[model samples]
Target: MASRRKTAIRLPRKYAKDEVIEVKTRIIHPNHNGRMAYKDQGYIAEYYVWKIEIFYGDESIITVSASAALSQNPYFTFMLRATHSAPLRVVWVDTQGDQYTESVDVVV
Candidate 1:
């Protein structure tokens, strides 16, 4: 599959050291589950995001395993402690083995 998906990352502009901060992320995808009929084209194939990996700097913070049951254009929000300046990254992998990544700098 073609990798042309859009991603977004939102974070606070200012945060104190060791302060808990909110991180928001999103990805644009169809997330087809092979159940939708397209006129006379039969059912759409089962294609959706299966895994998501979150990283704070070089450390893996969270990993999520998903299925076709997930909705299209998934959005996720989580909290993290602002320890130091580092890059917060999120990676999404679909059933087609396509990867989409987005990152933002978190300054403590």
Candidate 2:
């Protein structure tokens, strides 16, 4: 089983219909690129969040593709239009086929 990591998100609890709001997210990850080598250990295997998707209810809001170039514990901020009161889901998929999901309720 993949190790569980921490995630943080910030958004308004409520908003007017069609209101544009800022959504911020951060994930705690090592994001190894399989290129680094230590004096004792061999090359680290590549393990990074390769894709991220956000959804409002069943509708997809955004999708992002990331690479190893991204910094450790990547942070992202984006704008989303509030259309209804529903659960917002965020999903991240890593290179190792590990997935992490989280959700928060938003009132529109």
Candidate 3:
């Protein structure tokens, strides 16, 4: 069930030390469970991004447990203080054990 999904993160190219910044992330997915019916289909099988983990540099910043209640192509926005130059990574896992990851460098 592993496949590549379009994932993106938007942030500033450079930030000042201790400056609070906004991080926007998105993943292209259907996000449907077995309950939702589709055209000509009885019900869509269970498939969704079940978990999301965000990391700044070496520190774990956030972890989100998601469900099918989330809309398709889920978008997320959050704020964090830019403390140093490091990679900000987001990891997403789907119900079928599919994983998608995207990262951006936070330069301060």
Candidate 4:
């Protein structure tokens, strides 16, 4: 299925190693849980973004799991330590087996 999604994020342009930095993100998705759908279709089949994994450069940062209760466009805010100057990668997975990724460059 096509991932109709949009993501917004904020990160520090520079930081020190091990320094905590705030990160904010929001993703746009139909998040159609497929549990409720057109009467003729007998529900959409519960398709929604369920998991998200974050990576700082090659290092795995954090992972998150979500459910259909999430709003259509999910919002997330967290703190991550900058171990080095690298690009932060955020990948999200949906029930439809769709993946969405966003990246931010940071200098540590």
Each prediction's TM-score against the native?
0.89, 0.87, 0.88, 0.81
Question: Candidate 1: deviation at residue 20, Å?
Answer: 0.9
Candidate 2 pairs with clashing backbones: none
Candidate 2 weakest ten by summed lDDT:
1-10
lDDT of model 4 at position 49 = 87
Candidate 1: segments with Cα more than 4 A from true spot: 1-5
Candidate 2 per-residue C-alpha lDDT over 12-107 given as tens digits, one digit per residue, 9 for 90 to 100: 766788999999888888899778995677988899999889999999879999879888888888998887889988898899898888788878
Global Cα lDDT for candidate 1? 0.90
Greater-lDDT candidate between 1 and 2: 1
Candidate 1 local lDDT, residue 103: 93
Residue runs of model 2 more than 4 Å from their true location after superposition:
1-5
Residues 1-108, candidate 4: write the lDDT tens digits: 346448767986666778999998878887887677587858777878899888889988788898788888887889987777788888989997988899888776
